[model samples]
Target chain A: DVKVTQSSRYLVKRTGEKVFLECVQDMDHENMFWYRQDPGLGLRLIYFSYDVKMKEKGDIPEGYSVSREKKERFSLILESASTNQTSMYLCASRRQGPEQYFGPGTRLTVT
Target chain B: DQQVKQNSPSLSVQEGRISILNCDYTNSMFDYFLWYKKYPAEGPTFLISISSIKDKNEDGRFTVFLNKSAKHLSLHIVPSQPGDSAVYFCAANIIQTGANNLFFGTGTRLTVIP
Candidate 1:
């Protein structure tokens, strides 16, 4: 079985604070993704990394950045948290295919 | 401008009944489709998938039917259980520059009554 783990299951941050969400996969997948899910807006991609040090902006990448220094870990950074940034963040990984495995999401709340 | 759409926001079914979730896409370039189930506070998990070449795919009690001409697809769950209650999302595979990414629907919340 494939396991994808997220650093935090729940988090709360004040406005203008920096936040980090980490994800790690044991499958050594080549592609990793970050997405924020909202009530009426499904899972919108924030960023994705295809290889170490290589990143691409998804549909909604504003105010967010990602790091993939190693193949097994991917981190999402909120430069300065805001109320609008509060959402359910999800991380996924796949090995050069369309089938993706997801980790338990991190529910982030910004006050 | 939403490429993928799930017209129904929610559905309710009784246990031992069939539950059908529908999805539509505007992009004709999509060749692969998938269904995912998500519970509150959890990430979406892959349920089943179908390719454009095939019209139907089934796994255990879950089955997916695709209509290429209409660019639509549906997932049917037989003998629905209360544990099946969750948000179901439909996604399509889009290839961009040799990379395949999934474009997802807004999702339909399914509730099963015991």
Candidate 2:
């Protein structure tokens, strides 16, 4: 079984603060993704890393950045947390196909 | 533009009945589709998948049916249990350029009453 673990299951931050969400996968998958899920908006991709040090912007990447210094870890960074950024964040990893394993999401609250 | 769409926002079914969740896609380039189940406070988990070449794929009590001509797919779960209540999402993928990104639907919340 593949295991994808997120650093924090719940987090709270004040406005204008910096926030980080971490994800690690034991499968050593080459593809890792960060997504924010909101009601009626669906799971919109924020950023994705196909390989170490390589990142690409997804549909909604504004105010967000990603780091993939190692193959097993991926991190999502918020430059300045805002109230609009409060939502459930998900991390996923896949080998080379559509079947992706996901970690238990982190619910971030930006007050 | 929303490439993947799930028209129904929610559905309710009684225990031991069949539950059908539908999904549609506007992108004809997508060659693969998958279904995922998500509970509150948890990430979506892979349920089942079907390739464009095949019309149907089944695993245990879950089955996915795809209609390439209509660019649509459906997931059917028999003997629905109360524990199966969750949001179901449909995703489509195309690997033509080596970038395997999935386009997902808004998701349908299914509730099974005992």
Predictions in order: lDDT: 0.94, 0.94
Query: For model 2, how does the per-residue alpha-carbon lDDT over B78-98 read when each residue is reduced to its tens digit?
Result: 989999999999999986756
Which runs of model 1 end up more than 4 angstroms from their true locations?
B95-97
Chain B alone vs. reference chain B, TM-score for every model: 0.96, 0.97
TM-score of 2: 0.98
Native contacts kept, each candidate: 0.69, 0.69
lDDT of 2 at A17: 99
For candidate 2, what's the TM-score of chain A, rounded to 2 decimals?
0.98
Docking level for model 2 = high
Interface root-mean-square deviation (Å) of every model: 1.1, 0.8
Give the distance in Å from residue A107's predicted Cα in candidate 2 to where it truly belongs: 0.2
List the per-model TM-score of the A chain: 0.99, 0.98
Q: Give lDDT tens digits, candidate 2, residues A6-86.
A: 999999999999999999999989999999999988899999999999999999999999999999999999999999999
What DockQ results for candidate 2? 0.80
Q: In order, what is each prediction's RMSD in angstroms?
A: 1.1, 0.8
